[model samples]
Target: MIVLASQSASRKAMLDAAGIAYEAQSSDVDEGAIKRELIGVPGGDVATILAEAKALPVSVGVPGKLVLGGDSLVEVGGRQFDKPVSREQAAEHLRFFSGQRMNLHSAAVLVRDGITVWRHCETARLDVRQLSDSFIDSYLNREWPAVSGCVGVFRIEALGVQLFERIEGSHFTVLGMPLLAVLAALRAQGELEA
Candidate 1:
């Protein structure tokens, strides 16, 4: 069995949908501190770094088990955006994203006995349509609860899909878990059936 080190519902849904069996456990890592430390790194590398950080500690605690950790971030106009803390910030992010292309980078790592066995990071670009302030207000009112948990202030699985005019890359990448690659890695490691 694999151990999932994350509290994200989207990630759980991804694994469940893929038929990968995993025990969910929240990995306590100081993400804010890590983000601060890697302020100048590329978005995808930062995501990979955070994912490894989450996996290592949890893998150490559950020695010999397959522990998977994942992280995602939005890079727009050369700036990286994490999850929004408030509706206002989400609204602001959407406004800035209006009619622009933004990259969603997701990274995943597999660790066993505190050793990283596999790692992958993938990037997807979303082209958001121009949105009006009124639309933003209504969208926020409807999705803020679910939206705040995701980077880029959009779910892409729910009404958030409507926010994009076009998307380039894997759907799973935008969901904050590069799941297909992870699945392949699991099979290679003999944790999942080939």
Candidate 2:
């Protein structure tokens, strides 16, 4: 089993559905500080940095085990977005995103003994359809709080699908991890069957 350095439900579900066994450990990384430090970095690079930050500490603690750290971020019109702190902010974000193309960057890193052994990042493009205020309100009414923990204010596997008119990328990437690449890396490292 590997160590999963996040408490995110979507990550857990992805691993679970893939039959991957992992011990979930919250990385406790200060994300805001990392974002502040990475100001102006591309979204994918920022995600990779965040993923490494999360996994490295856990890898130190686990000593011999592989630690999987994953992170995702949203970029719209050259601005990076974090998880919305409140419903109002989420609504505002949706308004700005209306009919805009959103770049969702998901990244994952594998580390052992505090050394990163593998890393990957994937970007997904989601076209946000024109959203009327009533539609936004209705969507938020059903998805708030739950989606509050999600970047881009979405959980693609859920009602968040309604926000997009078109999506171009791996489904797993949109779900917030480069899961196929991660699984391949695990197999390459003999953590999973070849």
Candidate 3:
């Protein structure tokens, strides 16, 4: 059976929509500490490390199971924006992204028997619409709780899409998994039924 080593609803939905059977289990890793520890690493490398870190523990515990872990971050002008920790931070993230194009880096790792079997990183560019103060305020009020950890301060599946002027990337990457790549890896590994 496939085990998703993440608590993300979007990732679960993606698998479900594709008819992939999997169970969601939080890896319970200290993500913030992991990011801090890998601060010196390149952003893409850091994302991959974190993804593997999240999957390794789960893979070790469940022998013979394929465990998938994924991570995403928003980068603007060489700066990484982590999930907003407060309402004010969310508003600020929106403001910083306003009228600017930012890159979203998403990395995924698939582990089996405590070893990484597949890994991939994908990036997407999103041009955020110029946000007015009022709009930012309203958006924060409505989405602060749900969109906190997401890189772009918006959930494309919800009202967050309205904040983007344009997007250049696969839908799955934007949602944080890069579904096609993951599926290809799974198929190649013969983990998913053909």
In terms of lDDT, the best-performing candidate is 2
- Residues 59-133, model 2: lDDT tens digits: 999989999999999999999999999999999999999999999999999999999999999999999999999
Task: Give the winner by lDDT: 1 or 3.
Answer: 1
How much is the lDDT of residue 119 in candidate 1?
Answer: 96
lDDT of 2: 0.95
* TM-score for each of the candidates: 0.98, 0.99, 0.95
Task: Mark the regions of model 3 whose C-alpha exceeds 4 Å error after superposition.
Answer: none
- What do the candidate models score in CA lDDT, each in turn? 0.92, 0.95, 0.88
Count of clashing residue pairs in every prediction: 0, 0, 0
lDDT of 1 by residue, 1-194 (tens): 89999989999999999988899888889999999999889999999999999988888889789999999989988889888999988988889889889999999999999999999999999899999999999999999788888888887878999898899999999988998899999999998889
Which candidate would rank higher by lDDT, 1 or 2?
Answer: 2
| Predicted candidate 2, C-alpha RMSD | 0.6
Off by over 4 Å in 2: none
